[model samples]
Target: MATAVLVLATVTTGLMAGLYLAFSVAVMPALARVDDTTFVRVMQRINDAIQNPLFGLVFVGALIAGGAAVWWHLDRGDVRWWVLAGAAGYAVTVVSTVAANIPLNNRLDRAGPVDRLADARAVRRDFERPWVRWHTLRTLVCVLAFGCLCVALSVA
Candidate 1:
């Protein structure tokens, strides 16, 4: 049961990390550059649209399953700190996505096309950098949590 829980947590957190990895690590900086072509703009729109619904699943699924996974081990003699760390990691992933990503998405929606969008620089200045910072932090935390989960798996 513990093994299964850890597996679920591992898979879900890994899935959950996908968007953050793409954005901060991959897309945004690329988007920030370039001449903001139609293809580039459309890609941003598609990427933005796709991520929200996915995150909606990841945030809820990771938490409920992760919590249950941790609970499955808590009173058992096989308990490990990695399990605790993993459970906490999923919890942080939920908080960071909810608190950071969703709002940024909404702002992007409001900002509209990079070409016509007024105060694009303001959005770029005020929102983008901070969002990246928070996402990087979230990614680091999730990675640590996933690492701990891996350790738990090794012991169990």
Candidate 2:
């Protein structure tokens, strides 16, 4: 059971890291080339779409499974540090997202339809650079978490 949970945590963290990496490398870069209206509209749609069940399951599941893996390995001194490090890394990702990205997303969502906004460029201006910066941080943190989990799996 502990092994299964650890595997699940590692896989989910890897997936989340990949997702963030894609955003950092591709999605944001592609969006950056478009006009402000298109950028805002597409970004709003993406932010909305990303909240669906599968994404939620992976996002929340990583945290739960990581926590579970940490708890399960508490008595195993050889592997506990790696599992704890993985969990800590993931926790940083979660905290950063909640503290930074989510608020930016919420602000962008509340900015309403890009076509209707008096200054679509202003809305995009407010959202794009900061969002990209936060996303980059998220990507790095998740990748670190994924690496830690991978190490834990190997050592376990």
Candidate 3:
């Protein structure tokens, strides 16, 4: 049961890591090449689109499963420590997302459509760089969590 939960945690974390990796490596960079209007418009659309239930499930599930795995493995010394580490890493990812990225996303979303904005460049300036930095942090921590969970699985 513990192993199954740990596997679930690892898979969800890996999925999230892949998402962040995709944005970091491909999506953001591609957006960077476009004009401010296009960038902001596409990003706003994406932000709105990503609020769906499926993404929320994996995002929150990763944390919940990681915590459950830790509880389940508490009696197993090696597995407990690894699950703790993984859970801690994922916790940071979640915190950072809420603390840093979501606010920026919210601000951008509130800025209304790019076409209606007077200065799309200003909006993009406020959002893009900081959002990317936070997202990069999320990507790293999530990947670390996934790796730690994978190690826990092997040791178990």
Candidate 4:
């Protein structure tokens, strides 16, 4: 049962890590080449699209299952520490998202649509660099967390 839960945690975290990885590698880079209006508009649409239930499940599930993995491994000495570290790393990922990324997203959202804005470049300038930085941070932590969980699974 503990192994199963740990597997679940690892899988969910891996999914999130992959997503962040994709955004950093492919999505953002591709978006970077477009005009400011297209960049802002596409990002806005993506932000809205990503708020759906499925993404929510994987996002929150990683934390919950990582917690459960820590709980289940508490009696296993060093193994427990691995799970705990993993959970903690994921917690950082979540914190970074809420603290940094979401606020940027909110500011971009509040900037209104691209067509109506006087200067999409200004909005993009404010939103892009900071968002990418936070996202890269989250990606690194999430991948590290996934690595910790994988180590636990392998040795357990």
Candidate 5:
């Protein structure tokens, strides 16, 4: 059971890290080349689409499984610290997302349609930089968590 939990946590965190990494490397850069209106509209659509069940399951599941992995390994002297580190790393990922990304997303959402905006560039300007920065931080944290979990699995 503990192994299963660790695997789930590791895989989910890895997947999320990959998602964010892709955005930082590819998506955002690609979006950067587009006009402000296109960028704003595309990003808004992406934010809306990303809130669905599959993404939610992975996002929330990583935290739950990571926590469980930490708890389950607490008494297992060899792997406990690694698992705990994994949990801590994932917690940072969650905190950065909630503290920084979500608010930016919400603000972008509330900005309404890009086509209707008086200044679509202003909307994009407000959302892009901070969102990318927070996302990069989350990606790094999540990758670290995934690595810790992988080490725990090997040591366990």
Candidate 6:
């Protein structure tokens, strides 16, 4: 069960990190180039697709599994801060995605073209940069967390 947790957490960490790199870091600049209608459509697609409730379930599962693994290892005196780091990483991810992006998405959904596209771009610039920053922190935390897992594995 604990091992399962670790694997799931790793999966969660990897998935979010990949998304951060692909969308916020890579695709967003190009996405900014589209005309208003297409831009809104694409952004809307992204907003709709990104944060499914089921996706949250997957993330929660990963945390639970990984934490359980850490707990199991720590019970035997092979302990570390990585578990906490993983939790914190995911927490940052969830909070930032929910707080910043979701509202922007809602705004875009309700807004019209031209003006809305410009507004979306502004919001994207302000919010996306910070999102990337938090994502970097998340990746770091995941690295630390996985390192702790490796340490646990080694001691066994």
Summed backbone clashes in each candidate are 0, 0, 0, 0, 0, 2
Cα lDDT tens digits for candidate 1, 26-125: 6767766744344335545754777676666876787887788788778655455678888798688778878986687677667667787656556566
How well is each residue in 5-40 modelled by candidate 2, as lDDT tens digits?
A: 999999999999999998888988898899999999
Clashing pairs in 5: none
Per-model TM-score on C-alpha atoms: 0.81, 0.97, 0.98, 0.98, 0.96, 0.66
State the lDDT of candidate 5 residue by residue for 1-156, as single tens digits: 989988998898888888988998899999999999999889889989999999999999999998998888889998999999998999899999999999999999899988789999899899999999889899888888888888999999
Name the lDDT value of residue 51 in candidate 5: 92
Whole-model Cα lDDT per candidate?
0.72, 0.91, 0.93, 0.95, 0.91, 0.60
Candidate 4 stretches greater than 4 Å from native: none
lDDT (tens digit, per residue) of candidate 3 on 50-122 = 9999999999999999899999999998888989999899999999999999999999999997879999999
Which TM-score value belongs to model 2? 0.97
- List CA RMSD, all candidates: 2.9, 0.8, 0.7, 0.6, 0.9, 3.8
Cand. 4 TM to true fold: 0.98
Which candidate would rank higher by TM-score, 4 or 5? 4
Kindly provide the TM-score of model 3 when superposed on the true structure, using C-alpha atoms: 0.98
Per-residue lDDT tens digits of candidate 6, residues 47-103?
668668877776666566666665655555434355555555566656665676566
Which stretches of model 5 miss by more than 4 angstroms? none
Candidate 4 achieves a global lDDT of 0.95
Rank order (by lDDT, best first): 4, 3, 2, 5, 1, 6
